[model samples]
Target: EAGVAQSPRYKIIEKRQSVAFWCNPISGHATLYWYQQILGQGPKLLIQFQNNGVVDDSQLPKDRFSAERLKGVDSTLKIQPAKLEDSAVYLCASSLDRIDEQFFGPGTRLTVL
Candidate 1:
């Protein structure tokens, strides 16, 4: 099967602007996650969901970042009023369960000016 799919592979926006990313994970994978990978560092989990229900979001900046999984299939992540520090690569991953191995998408790179 093909890998996960993400759109707008690259994006650039000014501070305080809004941006959104889309992802479609492998079919039948129930667990989905969004991550932020800053340059030079490992990816940090932003939010996670299992079949459209949130599993964890403690690391997510709720004030500006939001995410949702539609019908337990596709997912979307958004960042509003972005800040300069928000510039990073946003990745999407999926797994059969919380403890299972995950498949990751190429990611959408965001550059906040």
Candidate 2:
């Protein structure tokens, strides 16, 4: 079982710019996760989904950040009008379920200037 795969390992953009990230979870995984990890801080759960239905997303910034998992498979996360505070490593993870061990991607490093 290989780790999840994310594209464009690094991204740099000005404040207010928009960016989208793609994630492909491991095969047969029933749960997917998105997290934001700022410098010096632990990864924060942005959203979680179980088989295409949102399980939890209270920590997500709904005003500018959105995500979707289609067919309970691949997922995407987008941040519009990116803010300086949004600069962080956006990580994607997956598990058999909420309590299962999570497999994480290397992450997309977003640098907002």
TM-score of 2: 0.97
Model 1 Cα lDDT, one tens digit per residue, 19-109 = 9999998988999999999999999999999999999999999999999997999999999989999999999999988899999999999
Off by over 4 Å in 1: none
Taking the candidates one at a time, how many backbone clashes does each contain?
0, 0
Error of model 2, residue 70, in angstroms: 1.5
Residue range 1-113, candidate 2, lDDT tens digits = 77799987999999999999999999999999999999999999999999999999999999999999988999999999899999999999999888999999999999999
lDDT of 1 at 36: 96
What lDDT would each prediction earn against the true structure? Answer: 0.95, 0.96
